[model samples]
Target chain A: MRIYIYRRFERFWHWMQALLVMLLMLTGFEVHGSYTFFGYENAVHYHQIFAIAYLILVVFAIFWHLVTGEWRQYLPTLQNIRAQLDYYLFGIFRNAPHPTRKTALSKLNPLQRIVYFGFKVLVIPVMGLSGILYLFYRYPQQYETLPFGFVGIKSIAYWHTAGAFVLVAFLIAHLYLITTGTTIFSNLKAMITGYEEVTDHHPTSDSQKQEEVVI
Target chain B: MKRIFLGLLLLGIFAAILIPSLFKEPYRPPLLSQLREKYHKKASKSADHSKFLPLQKPFTRPQEVTEACISCHNQRHIEVMKSSHWNWERLEYVTGKGIRAIGKKNILNNFCIGIASNEAACNKCHIGFGFKDASFDFQNPLNVDCLSCHDLSNTYLKASGGAGMPDPSVNLNIVAQSVGRPTRNNCGTCHFFGGGGNNVKHGDLEMALFDTEREIDVHMGTDGVDLSCVDCHTAKNHQMLGKVYSLSSMNRDRVQCEQCHTDKPHQQTILNRHGIKVACQTCHIPTYAKVNPTKMEWDWSTAGNLKNGEPYEEKDSLGMVAYTSLKGTFTWARNVKPEYLWFNGTATHVLLGEPINPTQVVKINELFGSYRDPEAKIIPVKIHRAVQPYDKKYNYLVQPKTYSVTKGDSGFWNDFDWQKAIQAGMQHLGLPYSGDYGFVKTEMTWPINHMVAPKSQALSCVECHSRENSRLAALTDFYLPARDRNYWIDHIGKGLIIFTIIAVILHTLLRIYHSTKNQARRDV
Candidate 1:
């Protein structure tokens, strides 16, 4: 049965963030001299512009998540986590029934919660901060009249590029995991249309009860 | 709910960065005008020197103007006469041996060789009258040319081969009437034209300084601070501060930027800590000769190339004189990166009689500094390289008479006779010449203190500390990251990170394996 899971704002934020992140990675890797698609200078300009837009998106999305209490979707829990791990590693290949149920609440089962939380709290902030510092490192107003030393731009570039690699790694894992849903297109369609097909009808957890009120 | 707090935190950070910047004041150089006014009291409440009776007369010789200047300002000529400008020399205090009188008049340089037999052409920059030969009087107070330094009209033209006088065509009366405080043009007439042309001797200085954009030179730029020469080289009693690298060390006259800007110019402590070991110019002036090309290499051995027995010249891609039959092959470059060196405010000059190693390329003057020295700072210097004649037997660099272009004489440029020119130059200095001379490579290092670019245009960190193509690649005295990396440390650091990541992944895999087995057991 089709159930309303992802909200309108949640789907919108996801798609927008996807587009911005992809654009950023494209121009960013070009700037990092991975392979030139756009020229380096143009890549840097586009990357900087996309970075600002991504930051604004983050601001609005954070507020939206708080107002609607959709942020609880990523709060990790031990319940059924071992069963979910067992399903991914062994039970899934043996054609066993899935151990965890996907409902309106608890969208990310345990592993996704930890990875997404770390990305949002740690990796993304590092990328944003290092990128912004590189943009204004030799800012005229800051250093022209009074030249002073800080951590050098070389170190900053190194950190920003490192953070980009982490994001790329996360993206690769995320793309592969999207196919591990009930069907290959199920997870992607749910993200796009704010609806998912589920077998269960009864609400089980307190989070499920809370999500029922919102729906 | 937690996301609202996170949103507020990010907003606060953005506000913290933007709000203070709106009210921050621009930098203002510390003013010493009030202190200077108290110490060196001005002669008048706007007293005009043009109305003075002695200056009102029609002047013929520059000496006549000097006579009028000293009549009222009696102590001025005496102070100038005692100065190195008028004397052309000073007692060497930094010498390892006992104090000896050394000056530009006695020095032998690779450019236009020396002042001995070529005094007529060279005396155009001299601050005295009739320095045409060794016998020229130095005791005459009236011979001091005041108009060269104090000329407000900017019409005073010191012609080559004019014996320390302004070219005769200039109306001396108007020059005398127009006396005022010296400007950059007044000082740069000789300085900018040193080594015969603009941007020749000192690569950092050029005619571009007269009207520059802020990008080329922030301090002297028209749109910027627009500072004159004397602003930094402050003169007290006509004795200006700063000693040229080619000249003897004038330690007392060295001007530090801290005199105007405080010791801690920056708000950040990281920069203030570096101020002790780094010069203001080291970071400020990333490159030299930004506006026009400066001579980088001069090969006098290739000189005397003639097109049908007549000297010819050729221009390069940048339109700089690439090949001159009279002066030889010259390589000029603009936006040239300077070599870094440790300088502890002292330099050891190679005087006229000093012995040199004829087998090796000699440093005409060596700046004395090292990492070990507590007072030393890494400074930027333009190392002017040239191939000039050296006395092989005597093991000394020769001062060839290069500019004396008489019809049948010993000038090197006129006849290309190295023996005659070297002999004449040595004889004038009262030193014995071996008559055997060979072309030897020589270098003179001039500290780059001008043409400060805006900080945005200043060199990025990688330009100095990168693995390849770094400006300071040749600086082996210190350790820098990427430029000088410890292999073991790098490997260990990377190895630790990689090992930790692999261990975490292995631990996660093992946990998943154990958990799956337990789940299967429960189901069975």
Candidate 2:
């Protein structure tokens, strides 16, 4: 069986999207007065425009994911979840065996499915909502008979800020996990070049049980 | 292909440059009023004493003028002679005792401190004559002499050292009227500061000028009705009002409310008949400005507010707002007075309403002056800060002991659940939390109020409750400064540090979870 899970456009979009996101985070923090890099005013201006670009890219990415059936990859499943856990925790460390193998037909292991599923479903939406709120917070006129006492710009501001911290954490973890691929640079290279070198033959249980190192 | 590549490269550069500058904020320093600038720079030069006294060689005052002043003010001849004014040509006071910068012959006044730190307040009055800019002898050249007040007809000056003049108070008030009158503006020069407190400016002089005639802003007010300059400035102290930059002879004690008005008897009789016990000033005229006349009222006729075919409880038979004995939004006008007014407090974002312990994550930019957003509204734009890490609010106890679960009768806090109680406590502190709002499975609310309850440890009264009991001190992450902007800024900076810890912790937890999984795999 064979499958082309990610189209060329999908891979190109993903790599570029990731690069832009990292750039945005760096500049967004500086503009938020976390530190000075490109000077305060410059940082702030860049953050605003970059945020717009991010929003535009997100729209395109969402459309692409929907039209090309790529969004299905993120739909989560719990099949053999325990085996996947065991594979990571115990199996891989001993170089014993991979309980679930990667294939063109099924790219992710169970654990990868669950984690990436969560990233798409929960983390991305939360950050996106907060960021959009932060940007468009100016519109609502903010007036009433007694100036709505219980709510304020503060609560909204805190939400956006808290959201920013979560995004920063996600980026850090994502960067670290990227290095855990076949080679230190393999995942990064695949993202850039749209091609990954997979083991030519599928490793069979009989071969692995006999301690064979199948090329 | 090469040309196409070059075109794309140029386009990329153009896009990068255009994106940031398009959203940039323009740089303009804070606006300083012309008068304020003049008050700082050529302050004494514009105070032409030559107009009061002619430019002449040192000559004694007109004999009759001295006799004229002596007629009523018979006491201080010897005191005047011994004063630095008497030794005007002598090398004393200027470099010796007055101006702190020189330390000698600088006997400007009773001010013991310099202008920079505000140890004393003579800088408000009796400032240096032609200070350093004139390149004259600061030690003993010019004196704000006794003659500057008493010599009414003739004036004298010694370009280098001395000058003499005599004047009457009324004439000076008249002449000084044109060249910056000694009115509320001059009073603000000193009284706006508490002379020597930590918070520098007293009144919010930075407040934008108000032109509206009426607003029922019951919580604030300034000048109106009988509450005029006389209400506060009831008396004049030193008969001689000092030079423009110098301190005035303001009789502070005489300015108290009791100093002038005899307690009115008619107010009590009316109150007795009505069975009400309250000060007439309390309800009738809420602020200083309302008590003073000539203050205009906003239009109530156009407001169209009426009740039962009448103009409501606001007016009496005379069509005046009964309580104020005038028309229009008298209540809001009263609130404008700085003395009687109070900030709604909530409007200022003073109350910490999110992340239960707002002090945990302070605004990093606020302390370092780093927070600003070019994309946001320009009304006092700033990088609104939350607290950061390394703060002392880790264990702050929050309140609001109950919360609603959802819209149904079942969700109300009628039943006592431990989860509800804990959630309530967190809510009071403005901590981060998620719960069911009506029609929604997941809704989050950050802290709206914070109260770190005192540890149950017994203590001396002064230990925990000493001076820490402000009306909302328990709820506040930052204290309102008694005197300094920097103090307030620093306090806010310190309070928001706790959140940085949360960020760091979250970051570490994720890394740890992944690392642990990776470690476990290798061990197998």
lDDT of 1 by residue, B1-524 (tens): 44555456456545644655566565564444544443334344255676778878888777888888888888888888889888889887654645668777887776676788888889989988789988988988988999898888888888668878788888888888788778788888888877878998888889988788778887677666667888889889888888776776544678788887677786544455557667878888988988888888888888877888778899999998988877888989998888998888777777777888867888887787775566678889988899988888888877777677574678877876667878887887888888788888999888998888877776655566456676777767755434554444445544554665664466456545765877898799
Off by over 4 Å in 1: A1-215, B1-45, B95-98, B496-524
User: Please, what is the TM-score per model?
Assistant: 0.66, 0.36
Interface root-mean-square deviation, each candidate: 9.6, 15.2
lDDT of 1 by residue, A1-215 (tens): 77768876677668868888999989876665455577654676677667776777787788777877878887767788788888877675555666777777667888778778888788888888888777656412212342423445566777776776667666655665676677768999999888888765555566556775784
* Regions of candidate 2 where Cα sits further than 4 Å from its true position: A1-8, A24-46, A101-105, A136-154, A157-169, A179-184, A200-215, B1-524
lDDT of 2 by residue, A71-128 (tens): 6666767888898777655554444445665544456777778877887777677667
Candidate of highest lDDT: 1
- Quality of model 2 by C-alpha lDDT: 0.35
Candidate 2 on B263-332: residue-level lDDT in tens? 3322222222211112222233222322222112222112224454343346544343433111223222
Error of 2 at B524 (Å): 20
TM-score of 1: 0.66
The interface RMSD value for candidate 1 stands at 9.6
